[model samples]
Structures are given as C-alpha cells and as structure tokens.
Target: MPSQIHTTEAGFELTEDQNCMSELVKLCTDRPELVLFSRPRDYYWEDVSAGEFLAEVYALAKGLVANGVEPGDRVALLSNTRYEWQLVDFAIWAAGAVTVPIYPSSSPHQIEWILEDSGATFAFVEDAHNFADLRAFLLREDGTPPLSGSASRLRRVAVFNEGGIDEVTREGEGVEQSLIDARVAAITHADIASIVYTSGTTGRPKGVALSHGNWMYQTRALVTNPIGAVARPGKRVVTFLPLAHVLQRAVAVALTIHGATQAHWADTSTIALELQRAKPHVVLGVPRVFEKVRNAAYNKAADGSGVGKRVFLEAERAAIAYSKALDKEEGPSFALRMAHRVYDRLVYRKLRDAVGGVAQYGITGGSAMSPELSHFFRGLGLPVYEGYGLTETAAAACVNHKGGQRIGTVGRPVNSYEVRTNDNGEIEFRGPGVFGFYWNNPEATAEAKHDGWFNTGDLGEVDSDGYVRITGRKKDLIVTAGGKNVSPGPLEEIIRQDPLISNALVVGDGKPFVGLLVTLDADELSRWKEARGIPASTSLEELAHNADLRAEVQDTVNLANATVSHAEAIKKFRILNRDLSEQDDEMTPTLKVKRNVVFRRFADDIEALYSR
Candidate 1:
C-alpha cells in the first residue's frame, strides 16, 4: 500500500515583524555602509551601498507616482536579469504597485497577452530590440496606435540601457520624497507584490498572484532554516537566471533580506569570468548549466593521451566511491582516501577554479538533476542541494539544506510549508508561500487548489525522513497500449547525461512500444568529431545519420532501457537535425520540453519511427 499521508511542517514561526519595504528600510539604516548591489562597468564592478540603493528605489518610486501610477496598479518589467531589473522591482513595490515580469525571450503575442491581462500601466524594457517588440505588439498593422477600449493601459516605456534612469529621475524632479514614503507606509502585507506568469508549456500562461506576505514569509522561512547559512552577511552571490522566473526573483529578495552582496551579470556568456571575479559563496542555477559544465569536463579529459585518460577515469571512480562512503556515514577507506587526495590535487582543483575557487555550495532547481551529476559534484567539494517547487509556490516548497541533505531527493519542507502526496500520487503543498490565486482566471485557480492545499501537478513520494523524490510530471506520464504506465523523465534524464546528447524525449503513449527523439550537444559534437580527425565542415544533419554516431547513442539508449521493464524500453529512435529551442516554441524558458509542440512539429518523423 502507498504510505500514509506524509506531512512535514516548518519548525519555525512566521515573521510578523515587517513588510518588504520595512525590511529594506531596516537594512539600509542598520548597514548603511554595506555593499548591497554591484553592477559591471567597463572593466570593473561598481558598488552601490545599501543607503544608496534605498535612495534610488525611493527616487524611482516617486517617479512612478509622479507619472500617475496609482497604488495597486501594475508595472511590467520586460528584460533579462540585470541591476536595473532588481531596482525596478523594488521601486514598483515601494510605489505601492504590483510588478509583472515578462521573459525577455517571450514572443510579441505573449507580450501582448500578459500586458493586457495584467493591465500594466507602465513598462521598463531592456534594450532597443525589446522596445521595438513591445511597440509593434501595442500598435496595429496600419502603424496606428491601439485605440481607447482595445488598447493597453501602458502609457510610458523606459529603455533601461538608454538613459531610462535619467528620464525617470527627471520626471520625478517636482515630486516630493514624502509622497513616495507615504505610499510605501500605507502598503500592507496582503497587497499583491507581483504577478509571475508560469512558463506555458501546455497552454496559455497564467499569471500567479503573489502577495507581499507570500514573499516576506518565504524569505524569512529560507533564512531561518538550515540553508540560511548560505545567506550570511559577508557572503556574495552572482545571479544571472531570468528574473521573470519566481526562483530567481525569490533569491534576489532573499539575498537582500539577508544583507548579502549581489553581483548582477546580464550577459550570461561572461558567467565564467563573472564567477571568478565575484567569487560567490553560493551559486544558484538550473540543471542545464551544471550539466554543460560536467560534459565539458569529460570532453576535456577524453582529449588526452593514454596515461592521462586512464588517470582521469580512475579519479572519477575514486570520487564517486568517496561520495558514497560519505553518504553512508563511513569515511573513505585508506586506499580510496589516498586516491582522492591525489586526484583532488590533479583533477578536482582545476574544476573548482572554473566556477571560482570560493564557491562552497550550489542550489539547483527548475528541473530535476541527475543523481550521478549530484554525486560527482559532491565529490568535488561542491555539494549541490536540489530543491523542488513551482511558480505558484513562490519558487521553493522544499530544499536540501547543508545539515540535512540527501542525494536524489529534494529535501524536507521549509519552516512555513507542509508537503504531502495525494491519493493520485501528485505532490500537494500548503503554506504562506503558496499564491492565493491566478490573476483573472478563477477557473484555473479553483482547479489548482482544494481545501487549503495547492496541487503541485508533479508526481512524487516522501520517504520516512520526509525527503520528497519527484518521479515525473503527472500530466506527462505515458500509458502504453499494453496498459503499462511509464514515466519518461528518468529515461530521458539518464540519456541526457551522456556527453553527446543534449536532450531526449521518450514517447510511447497509446503506441505499441516506446521510442525516443534525440538532439545533440552541438559543442560537444564538434569536439567529438575533431578528436576523431573528422572535418569540422561536416554538417550536423550528416553526422546524425552517421553509423558510428548512431551506435554511440544506441549505447546510451541501452543503458536507459536497463532502468525499466521490457514494455517501457525505447525500441527505436530518430535523431533530429536541429535541437528543440525556445525560439522554435519547442522548449519553455525554463528549458522544459514542450511535448505537445514537439509532437506536432515532428509528426512525420514520429510516424516514421513506428512505420516498420
């Protein structure tokens, strides 16, 4: 029988002390000299003291009020992660208005829907490109502006990279600072702070309404929990993930609340250098970032000669064994310890330097991380703590802390939430962190919540120790014609672990047998071909049809098949000429595959797989 309804509540109480603005005030007053934010200048990072940041926030808040933005109005931010994005978010809150964040990569149509749905009055865009996209969306084909009733409420647009701050400051020149302060004081915890739209994979995105109390409670719960150690006063963090995502937004707030210094890197291409320069104590990322690092390490090791390659393989074995021994509470054996010591100096040290020598911990979410990758990192002295939650849960419901961490499981619930599996095996949670409703969508809100518990739509189970292990998405579970229930997540996760494979989708629903659709890691593929003396000019499509490449992928498939029964094994597969991407609408912003979109786009290829 399934286990009894497992429940784990936070061992702490809610902080009834202050709202977000109140906390910011306290931080600025108490630690005025401390650096709160750092933005990149030409070749150096320029610091903004806590006091300075608060002043800027107040100035912008006054600017919004001066421009006729009323309390409870919506202000949208369409941009990549940057210093201005953080400032604008706080300013929106300080102005007693709700923030609506749109992904920079969102299509014009998506931009139109979100702006209209949230009734945004003002918007801040990142660059010229974003400004054009928003402008086109708000105007008609004949080049005329949207008329009265059919138009967006947006009356002003500020371009962040082009004198936007100066314009706002200029607009607020005549407005009294006392006006902005009064608005901030009048705000209550019950007021909505933001409307974060879910990355729509199956249908239109729904705006999740998160109140100030929801974020405040989440920040307090995270800081007081064991994971709070990562947020120590002198610690630093580098944030590059999309701020539109609730996870990054929550982290940004939590860091500010904890008084940790934040370094913003808008250009993700320079993440390596940024890490080295910032030397953050804690790093947060999605599984894709970690996976690429791991794959790159392996590819580099494989490029060596006989002795070097053998040493690298032996070192990996030692690391994995050492990690396993640690998990069992038994120290590494003498031989293994010696091997680890030798390898730590030779192999692991280089890997550590790549992410900056100061990083001691990493937090991964947005998707399930492979256990192999988790263990491998732990072996390198960088313990990656996996967490689980959705946009509706304010980014994190449960997370593994430093003191109580288990590999392959998204640890116990934080101090304010309770997690349990329902009768249908879906994870359900209830807490202050859970959002109250979906903006303007009563039906979705009703379907998503019951009694007081919010259904997470993820299939998972809780161990006796209360660690939750997500099995698969409840909606993505495949039921074959033979009546076998299979989850494609695990199989795909295992396949993607191979250095050459970028992504894999297992499909067998209502079919005779299982099959796969695979995409290659373009970089790794190039390196792979170069190592074998193949010409660099060889096209990816030609390589996909190569006999040798297919056989190598087959080996990965065979390994994945071993994880399941005969009925669930991938019987055949087709290598796609191009990888699924966000631009193609085949993947979500969070890098989740859009299964329905892929199915439609590759209908012919899928049919060809089963034709025989």
Candidate 2:
C-alpha cells in the first residue's frame, strides 16, 4: 500500500536458486582455489570452491530426495560455523526442502524440542562435537536403540569435517561421487527456504518461517545499497560472529552473491592475526570486538612508570580535544592541528595496526553500538559504520550507504522497505526483506502480521532527515511504579562504553529505582590492574568487589546517568563475574543478552535494591 514500491514488481522473474545464487556460482567456479573461506580444515583450502562446495551438497541433496525427502520436508543442520554448514543449508533448499539451522552449543533438551517441533526428516551434523550431543539425546532421553528397518521419517545424519570430503553415506541410498558433483538446480521463490527459530528468552522457541522470496529480497537489498558499494571483491575479511545468527549468514551469503571472495578465521581469538596476515579490505565486527581493539590501543600507548604515562595521556587528551572542537563546526586551531598530526603518527597509527593496518571500513550490527566507539575508531582513521536488521527480515532491512552515513544511528532503511510507526509506538515494516509467519504457530503468526505490517517489536523515532534512532525494544522498556518509563538499550549502550565492561543489562520494573547487572571486559581489567599498581586477583568476581574497580564502574554509571532523564537514571548496580553464556541460557547464539533469564535469575537481587 506504500507509494514507494511498485506492487506489480513485488517478486522478481528469475527462479529462486538461479536468480539468488547465480553470482555465487560464477565466483567460485571461476576461481577454484581462491581461499573463499578459512575454518577448522586449514588443509582443505586447496579445494574450497563454490563449485566444489555446492556439488557435494547437491549430491547429498539428491541422495536425500532419493531416500524419501519430499518437497517442503524440514531438515535440520546442526554445527558450528564452517563452509559445510552453509553447504547443507543451500542443499536443503536445492532439494526443495526447508532448513532448520540448530546452534552448535544446543543442549540435549533444546535440540530435542527443535527436532520434534520441526518434524525434521534428516539431519546434517558436524563431526564428533555434534555427534556426541546427538548421540546423548538418543540414548539417555529415549533409552531406545536405532529403529532398524523401521519406516521412520527421521532417517539419518551425514557428517562433514572442517572442509574435507563433503560426502554422504546412507543405509537405503548409498551416496556416490559423480551423483553428488552434479549441480542442484530446482527451487521456486514461493518455496520455503528456512525456519530460523527465535531465542526462547521470553518463552519457548518460536520458529519464524521464511520463503525463498523473503531471503532473496534481503540478499538483493543489502547486496546493492550499502555492502556492495562499500566492500570491493578479492579483498580479505575476518568473520568472528557465529554463523548461526542470521546477520552473519545473510552477510556472508551476500558476499558470496556479490563476488567478494573472503578468508574466515577459526575463532575470535585468532581473528586479529588473521586480519593482519590477510590485510582485509573490509572488517566485519560487532561492538564487543571494536571495544577490545580500542582498549588495547589505549593500553599500548600507555607508558609504564610515572612521567612517561602522564605525557602519553596528555597527548591523547590534546588529540581528542582537537577532534571535539572540529566536530562542533569550529576549525581546529593551527597549534591543535599540529598536536593531532604528531599524535596521529606516534600513537593512533600504531593502534590502527592492531586491527589490520589498512581496513577501509568496518561493518557492525547485532547490538546497539556506542557512539564513543564509533568516534574513537574514526579518530584512529577507520570509519566504522553501523547497520540494523533482524532474523525475520532475512537479516538486513537498513544499512549506511558507503560515503553516506551519520556516525551514531544505524543508517536509513536499506533494500527499499516501507516503514511507518503505528499508534502503539511499534515500528512495523513491509518489504521483500520481511519474512513470512512463524512456522506452524498460527497464533504467533497472526499476532506478528497485521495486514502486511510485520511488527519489529522495537521502538524508534525518525529524525528530520528520516534517519532512525532505535530507542529500545517495546518489551524491554522498564516503567517504574511512579509511571516514569525508561528504555534500557540506549542506557545500556552508554554503560558498555567502559573499556572494562563487556555487557550490562538494566533492570527496574514495577520497582522504585533502576540498576544494572554487568559483565566485565576481563582482559582489559587485568591489564588495568598491572598498569595502575593494583594487584591482580584469581577471579573476575574478586576484581568486581575491589574498591578501585567499584569506583570506576560507579563513575561510568554516573556519566551514563547524566545523559538520561532523572526518572531513567541508574541509581545502583552490581558487577557480574562471568560473561553470559549458553550454559546459563543468558545469551542467544548471537550473544545477545536473554533479558528474561537474567531478570528471573536475579529477581531477589533486583528487588532488594528498591528497599534501600
């Protein structure tokens, strides 16, 4: 109904797989040994081509179809990030099946619920790590043997190593080489491609159904507007975010579609060196990674003993002060510019090397980013921009166009979306990027879509220029007993500005005051101790209660409080020792804080603050 789009062109004319993935096939087939990806199988780089990857997966798909996989059958792929994980996903769609991507760290219970709910006919799992867990689920939970010779729809699971021999061995249908190497070429836009489950932070996991048309819209939007314009091909990249999250999946898939051959690292720890070695033209990172780089730069520039550290700190002060003056439309004084030039060569340039020397731009998403982090990086000579999207939007609906961005907010809506705010203060979107209903949950599906409007569940207000400032999630707002409402996201972003704090969740609903539960940036805190003459402790918990550390957090809280209204100010907080992990279900696979779990676990602690 929006005038911005021509409804007659609602869908593209090309067939699903062809239009969506033809470019990817071209790149990989053209260069078979281009090191398209790096993972646990370092030795397999010799054969890491899109042609090689897809052929084996297509062969497996054909085998599955022969072994009784019908159209619309939902299949699950359980694994950590690897080229094969993506292969299985594409193969499922190529076979006219829907994919259900399960996280690598899923416990037996979560996996069981997904398996039963999705009615998965087959599964593709990573080697031993995936097998041990699945094996455990079958044995202890069911306490039954494999139903030999049974006509069960849940047939078998194929395993692929880090990158070698993407093959299949089946009971009824033995998979062969040539059959697996043929191109898998049948799919329709209307066909369901995948059902990515929502994090069960509020309730049980709800599978959001997405069609090929939905992902295609997503792929086309992000690929053309911002990412395509920004990252040139043959440039190296470092991917640290979990591929289980749709953001990484969509971005990586977009790269493949756009002819950007990339190099991936095994894990986050190895990412820095990989970037340095690869000299990546574009760096895709989350706020946490950027925060780490900033802190490390700050530490590196610090001189050990008394006078040296003071002089270095003075230079940083002068550099930042000069930058701030320029930000206000005032030309930098000649003396200040000279000071910045000196500091740039001596201090900031060394910091840039810490994050791969020549990174043209860094792309960020998944969580709200600190404006401070953005400014710090730009000051250090890397222009890191932000993006906004969700799993239901096939990942990206908006992004900052190259050479077209304002530092703070996630750039305007990308991929040609129709956006309007409903009276309920919720942002409802309608576009090709928007997905279908939640799989099989009609109640949820109906609730999420009103006419064609997909409720984003986030709150935002538009700027004069149409830029959107995301305040917070509708459900994440905390309204005090006095009727004063506060959005935790902006405040949380401010608190996370601290170099030694990784994440913070602000809580205060139906209570007199607001407080925070924080996860510290451990490595930074340890370094801070050594540099400041403070003693080191065994656990972060001990450090959290340290007088100096407590005061530092209090100062950060105080600074953050000044930015919000009196009603929204955080009066108190407690520092948490461990980062929220899968074991606690305190975070989603994408590492987003599961608010419901945190609130429930510390209900007593949250309530006690109000008594004071």
Candidate 3:
C-alpha cells in the first residue's frame, strides 16, 4: 500500500509535505516566464518562466483535453534533450495523464513496443529523427509489419519542437489536434506522472510507472540531502546528461524548485567551453569525462617526448605537497611552501585550466566510477564526490555530503533515505523518494520490493562510517564451478581506471576463472598518439592488435589484478575496438554498459580466452 504523503518546508520555501505536487505547479503559476529553461546558444532561448510556462502548458493541456486526452491516458515522449520535452511531460502531467519517455535515438521497434505496452494515447516526437523512425515503424504501406502489434491504441501524435493544428491521418482514420488538446487539464497528486521503461538488458523492458507523488516523493531525498546543497539557491550548474534519465532531470527541474541559476544548456561538443563560461558551482559527469580529462593531462605531460611528462609529474607531486600544506591548519615550513609554490604555479594550475576552472566540487554518476579517478581528482584539489542511485529513487539516495566526502564510496544515504544491505549484500532502500511500482507490471514490481524496502539490484556493502561501496550486481555475480564467487563490477571498475580503457565487462559465470573483453577509448588514444608517433588515421581495431599497445594494457590489467585474490584476477583479456553504442543495444540511455549485451557479443572472445 502507498504510504501517507508528507512534505517538509524546512530548508526550502516550497512545501511542508513530500507529496506537494500542487506546490510545484504553484511555482509555475507564480513565475510564468522567469527563464525556466533555455537551449544551448546553439539552440534558441525559449526564455520561459514558471508562470508563463505553466499558463501555456495548461492551455496545451486544455487543448489535449478537448482532443479527448482523458485522465490516466499514457502519453509517450520520444524526443531529444530539450526544454520542449520537459514541457510535453509537464503538459502530460498537467492534463492528468501518465508520461512515457523514450530515448531520442530509440529504434523503431522500441518506439512501437513502448507505445503499445503503455497504451499511450498520445506521443510527442522531437524532430525528424524520431518522427521518421516512428513513421517507418507504424506505417509501412508496402506490406511491411508494424513494429509492436500495430500499436492500435495510439490515438494522437504531437511534435515537441513545432506547433500544428492539423491532425495526422492514415487510411481515413484520423487523429486530430483538436481531439488531443481537449483531454489535457490541470493535474493533481492522484494523477499518474510517467511510465518510464527500463532498458531491460536482462530481459524485456519493464515500464516503471511513476506518479506525481512518486516524482514529488523521490525529490525529497534529493532536495533535502546534504550533497543536494552543492548548488544552493544562487549556485549555477551546467547539465549535459540526457534529461530522459531521471538523474539529470532531477538536477535540472527538481533543483530549479530549490532555486538554482541556469546559465546555458551545453552542446554535446562544447562541454569544456560551457564549464568555462558557466563556472558552474555544480556539475554532473560520467566516468568518460574524468577519463578524458585525466588522459589530456597525461598526454600534455607526455607530449614533450617523455622528459616533459616526467617534469609534469614532478610538478604535480610538488603541487600536492603545497596544497596539503596550505590546507593544514598549521603553516607549512618555508622550504616546503617554496617548493609547493613553484609546483602550483606550474603543473596544477595548468591542469585546472584544461577542464575550466572547475576548482569546486562536481558529481560523477550514471555508471560505476573508478576509485582511482576519485582519488586522482582529489589529488588535483578538485573534489569529484561519487554518488549512487537509480531513476526509481529519483537520482540520489546516497551522496557524499559536500563537507564530508569519502574518496571511493558513493557516500551515505541522504537525510530522507534509509539504506541497508540484504543478506546477499544487495543494497535495499526505504525512503520517501522511492517510486511506487513498474507500470502495470505487478510481477516486476513485486520483485523490486520487499515489504516497504526497494530492491536496488546492486550488491554493495557499507563501511563502518556508512559510505556505500558497490561491488557488483546480484545478477552479474559469477560463481565458479569450484563455487568461488566473484563480483565483477569492482574488477571492472579498476580496469576502467586505465585511461585507454573506456569499458570492461568481466565474464566467468559457471566457468573456471575470469576473462575480460575491453573497449579502447579512441579519444584518449588519440591524445596518446604523439608519444609513440602513432598516426591520426590509426583505427581502434588496428590499435587493439598493436603489441606495444597490448603490453601497455596488460600492465594496467596486471596492476588492477593485484588488488584482488588470484582466483578473481582476469585470466585473459581481449581488446575490442568496436565501440558499444546506445544505438546498438550496448548501453543504457544514460550510457551505462549493458553487461548482458557485452557478454553475448563477446561469447566468442570469452571462449577464445579459455581455449588455452
């Protein structure tokens, strides 16, 4: 049963109850056009505030309502990251309907599957990209089959980036704009919010039904957490992670309710420039970002043909010593301070300059981050506090409180959440923020909950101080024929610390020992080119077979292997140059590697690894 709702207005001026969806709407009512969101300079500024935004959205909701968009209707949003996508979602909620968000790059089959599964009465497409895909899937006049059982339930279609009064028709069956516009109206807590489908690497995608109360409830853990204060009312942040993911959405809109300054929405390319321009007090990043930054620093040092790299390392050592001395309550000795000053002026300053003066703390999430990356950032005097959570929990259940961050763990549960480890070490959560259930999938929902506790699906343990250390997924656990249990996520994380390695999936389940199949991050390798005089045209596949490169990777793998017992060490590894892309079913929309996909694709490689 759903718990009674409560809200708190302690630190925020918003609401006292966690389920105050109306208060969130009231923010829109009060400031209709206070610059709620803007696209990157690459895109145009809608310059909408809460009030005007809500007014227009409510008008659109009314439009949908008039078009027969009845309450509880599921509306699908298959669009790219943009303000309009949020608007459509907001409109869906405003109209007292459920929203189903699809990745902008979702294949035609997925589009139809979600539409059919959620019984979406309406859908908003971003542009020609998804619009074309949906068209191809739904209407193949040349005797081709529809992607998902004809999606007979779909009654209306809307474009997020454009406005039109005309309805679309096929075979004389028409869906009119007027019909969609009629069903939308003001939404309330009793209204369903969204039906978000999981990527479902293990099986079929399950629609995770989130309610207005669910979004509102999960937000408490984030808006009330210690780390949630990273960007206070006045702080600025830049977001690049896809808004389709709840993590990024919470940081953008949910945090807005907390009063944050939005500078710009960055293009996928100019994130570096965006950071420099925004000087964001808070940032969200994936492991790839950190790896790129680390590689750039190393390459710059290595660019002088080895001697320069050594000098850079020496300078870094000096800088760390200096930073430590400065942070010490007691002043450093004159001699040490003098050495530190020299290093600070030379190495550390340049490194900081590279990624923009992101001297303050930022966040790293989406997938597992290497502990070395965490320690490396700390060494540079930039705090990259790790956080762990899922969309179901609304972005953050545990985050390293800004004032007290652990180097490796994903910090403690936020003020609003309680985290405990089950007997199998899987993290279980009970919080105001936990989502209710998967949309219409009682079996999946049952599996995800135990009493009131939400199953995190991740196997982890808490340190004595309570920081969460994720080891692996319960599903990813490998029990050798000899009954030696191995959690691959830890080893995989350690392997990914190597700048050249973007992703590593360990396979050994039902086998004797572990083997690794890896992906080379081409960008980092391009940076490493100068040291070995490698040409720009060198392909990742070619690089994979390069003996010299293989030796370098082996050395990295060996170092990672040393941290664990011999039985758990990766017995063999093969470099895979083929990038695992979201389009190819290799990654979640948030860019987390799909472990099942990796294993299946590399079955031949795994067999080869064990052949000897």
Candidate 4:
C-alpha cells in the first residue's frame, strides 16, 4: 500500500526579524529602482518602482497612524483586485494594523458581519457603489448612525474614487516617516497580519487569522520551489483574481518578494485585451477562467470555415496525444512530432496569441480541473498547473510545478508542508502556510485543527509517488439507496467541460439513482443557437424544451455517464432556463456553486427529476 503521508522539506527558515513588510522594506533598501508593479494607464502600462511604491505605502501608513490607527487595529479594505488594493494592504501592515478584506461583491449584511466580527476601525471602499453599500450599514439615509451595534467600531470610511488615497496621504503629511518605520519594525512572524474570511460555500463565513509569518513563509516557499523558475524576477504576471481570494493574495506576495512586475486588472470581462497588453510571462486564474479560454477557442474554430474547424480538431487531438506521450518513457513519435509542429503554426499559435504571445504557462485553482482540459492545455504548449488549498492554508498547500507536472493530481506538498490522508480519507495538512486559529472562533478552530494538523474537510488520496489527488468534499459525499457512495465532483467537472453547460450539480443521496441539474452558458447558448439556425431572440424557456438542444445536452450527459459505474452515473438530467450567478446567492465570488443554496433554491427542479 502507498504511504498515506506526504512531506516536503522546508525550502528555507524564516528569520525572527523577517515579516511581509520587512520583505518589501528589504527590496526598497537593496534595489529601490527595481520595477515592482505596472499600473494600466491610457492604452499602456505605467511602471512603479520599488522606491516609489514604498514611499506611497509609507505615506499612507503615516496617514493611517495620524488618524488614530494603532498596532493590532483591524482595518477593512473593500475593493476588487487593483493597484490600490495592494497599496492599502501594505500600508495597513506598515501601520502595524491587521487587514480585513471584504469582497466588493459582498452584500450589505455580509459586509456588516465581517466588519463587526473583525471589529475593523477604518475602511477603504473602491467606488461610489461600494461606498453606498458601506454607507448603508454605517448610517441611515438621514445621515445618522444606524440603530444597531453592528460594525459600530468602524470610525471612518474612505472612498478610493473620491480620492481616498490622496486624502489619506495628505492627512499624514505632518506625521514622521520614522513612526511608520517603527510600526513596521514592531511587527513579527507571530503577529496576525490579516483576518481572511472564508468564501462560505455552505453557511456563514468564518474569519481565518493568518499571521505575518504565514505569508512570509509562503513568499519564500513560492520563489524557492520549482514554480520560482518562471515566477522569478523580470517575469510579468497580471493580477485579476479578486485580492480577497487568498490564492491571489499569496501570489501577489510571492511576486513582490521575487521582484516580478505585476499588473492589476480588476475587470475580467476584458481579460483577453488585458492579457494581450500585459504580455505577461505567467497567467494565473481559477479553473473557470481556463475553461472559458479553452471553450472560447473551440467555439471560435467551430464557428469558422469547415477547413479551419477540422484543423483545430486535428490540432487538439495531436496536442492531447503529445502530452500523453511525454508521460511515457518513449516520447511522442516522429510522425506525431511532425504533425504537432505543423499544427503549432496553423492552430496552436493563434491560441497562444489570444493570451499574449509571451505567456509561458498558467496556474489554476479554486476548484478541480478535469484531466482532459489539463492535458489539452499542456498539449498546446501552455501547461496549466493546478494546486490544492483553502483560505485556511493561505492559498496553496501543494501545487503542480514545472518539470514536476502531474495531470490528475494537485501535486505533492509544497515546501515545509506535510499532507496526509486520515483513516476517513480526509486530507489533512500541517505547514508554515497553515493558520494557527480562526479569529475569535476557538471552537471552530479546535474542530478544524488538532494537535498540529488541519483537517481540510476535503477527501483525497496520496499516491505512492506522493502526488495528491482530490476525490471530493468529505461533506459532499452522496449515497444511493443501494449504499453506493458517489463523489459528484469528478462527474460534474466533466459535464461542465461542454461549451454549452455553465454549471452541473449531481445529486443522489438516499435516492435510488443519480440525477443532474444543469445550467446553460448564456453566451455559448447564443452562439450555439446562431450556428444551428435558431432564432436569435429565442427565449430560454422555449429553448429549454427544444428537441435539438435537449439532444445536444443528452450527448454531453451520455459522455459523462460513460466515465462512471451505472449506479454513480447520472440517470436523468434537466436543463435550467437560466444560469447561476453570484447575485442570486447561488455562487461564491470564486465561481464555486453553493450546494445548499442551490438545493434550496432549485428544490422544485431537483424533485422533478425523481418524481418522473
């Protein structure tokens, strides 16, 4: 039997004086002129050097200090991923304050809960909309304080669109820079850096307390690990994933530590344009982003001339084949190599050009990625590495890296991390990246971490080669009437690959058979309808019952069914008239479906599958 436990040696030990702030300070001191970040300005990128960024950070830190922010104070930052998000984060640290990031998409109730829970004193909102939401909780329409004590500790709210950064900087003009330095120097590895709340795929979100040491450790681990090969200095990466996401936050730290130039782009709608403009060496995204990229390419080719479509199909097969061959002792044959080279120019080059001609590879997480999609990307000469971790672990506990690539697995434990499967098959982790406790939630903390190990609530297996393959959520396992246990994640991942399907949820718990509820991708459906000669303005309700549409979905379902046993296979499926969205509270900010929320909201739809 394969060993259940997998461990990786620590890349480097942290010094007592080192923290996330110190890392930045060291860079500014050592190489002040080094370009650290690029901010988009009218059509081009404006570079911000280390010294410039540090100076701004200090100015803001002084502003924060002059405004009564004290060491250990929790300051709230409500915004999307942008240059200012990073700016406010470091400035908070420089003032010896803990950051509490609230998603810009968060509801007023959610925002109030986080603010009250974290007891944040000051806050920064990105724009008028965000400010209005925060204002709703802070004051009544009459401009008086709200009745409740929720977030009462919050003293002031700053709006970025209203020149919040400039206001804060100006307020600190009289404060000495030495005070900011002293505050930064006072912070240590054990001091709490941020209280990150979980995305709450299930119930209420809990705040995970991450220390400065946790982030510093990850900064070192990322640059020293195999990933650092391309993530090192001079490389450029675009930051688009919400900074509230721990994965993006940690990656930002790593990029800063390694001197990589980062560009901030909050809007993903123009990701293609941003990618082309940044021309980054590395691209980072969630699984859905990669899925969209692949689907878009395929759909574009399918929509083109028949010859182009055929060439794309051939290129795709060749790529998957070439990737699989690389895994074997005997690599791709001469004929296959020749075919790949030809297709590289004809098909793959365009795919590469779509995401900037310079991208070397991509990193994806936040959910499981189908091996088929991973192999397809790898075949395109742009391998997309997948990693596994949660906000509790500060992003990635284990990640697939260059030269150590594994398609199905999330890869071995990262430096200084130990991963193992308990008797119940739940993945457990212990490492520098792991958090010590949840903010003011000792009971939840005790339940999650025992001795030194953090039970991830996710089930998985560690193969003999030490690769970690996630199976499913331990809490999400479904058992049929026949007592056959099924993990829906793998099947759902496959079903979601079809361009027309936006989301799939598998359900069979205590039922006689498994069933699926699927939502359609609106854009894909529009394109699909156009290609099939359907009316452009066809209503979703009408299309839901369309024979051709049903048949196409059935084909997708059949493909998924073929991959599993009859008991675990989806026996019935229904296409929803609408797609899921974050606004409906059916999806998280990271695009993960809220299973319980979906179950409740779609109870009628789910029941219809069984009643029939």
Candidate closest to the true structure, highest TM-score:
4
- Writing each residue's lDDT as its tens digit, candidate 1 over 1-612 gives 334544455345444446777789889889888888888788877998899999899888888888889999999999999899999999999889999999988987788889889988789999999998777445454534575555577777889989887799788878887888788788776789999988868989999999888898777777765447766578888988898989888988888866888998867667878888888888889998888767666767777766776777777777878888887756788988888899999888877887888888888999999888888889878888899888899988888878778988998887778888888988998888899999999999999999878998989999888899999998899998899899999999999998889989998889899989999988888877987788999987788788989999999999999989998999998998888898887888778899999999988888888899
Error of 1 at 503 (Å): 0.7
TM-score of each: 0.96, 0.87, 0.85, 0.97
Rank the models by lDDT, top first: 4, 1, 2, 3
- RMSD value for candidate 3: 5.4
Error of 4 at 602 (Å): 1.1
TM-score of the candidate numbered 4?
0.97
lDDT of 2 by residue, 510-561 (tens): 8788888887887777777887777775577677677888899999899889
Please give the TM-score that candidate 1 achieves against the real structure: 0.96
RMSD of each: 2.3, 4.3, 5.4, 2.0
Cα lDDT of all candidates, in order? 0.85, 0.70, 0.68, 0.88
lDDT tens string, model 3, 1-612? 322222222222223333333544656556544455545444543444556666556556666666677788877787666656666666666566777888776666677778778987667786666666666444344534455457446655666545531232121134344433343324444456777777656677778766665576556556655436643445666667777777777666665565455544525667777677667766677767776777677766776567777877676555545545544688567886666567657676776776567547667777777765665566566767778888777667777756667656788776566777877667887765677787768887898898888888888777666678787888878998678888888887778877677778888888888888888777677776755789988887777778988898899889879988999888888887576888788887767777877788878877887898
**Per-residue lDDT of 1-612 in model 4, one digit per residue for the tens?**
323667766457888789989888998888888899999777777999999999999999999998899999999999989999999999999999999999988877788789889988789989999988777556454545575544457778899989999999999999988888888888888999999999878878999999998898776776665458655668888999999999889989788866888999988999998899889888889999999998888888888877777888889899999999999999999999999999999888888898998988898899999998899899989999998889998888988988688899998888888888887888999887799999989999999998789999998989887789999997889998999999999999999999889999999889989999999998889888887899989998788888998899999999999989987889888887789998888888899999999989888888889996
Which residue runs does candidate 2 get wrong by more than 4 Å? 1-18, 26-35, 38-47, 136-153, 162-185, 230-232, 303-339, 531-535, 538-546
Regions more than 4 Å wrong, model 3? 1-21, 28-34, 40-46, 136-148, 161-190, 226-233, 263-267, 304-308, 311-343, 350-359, 527-530, 533-545
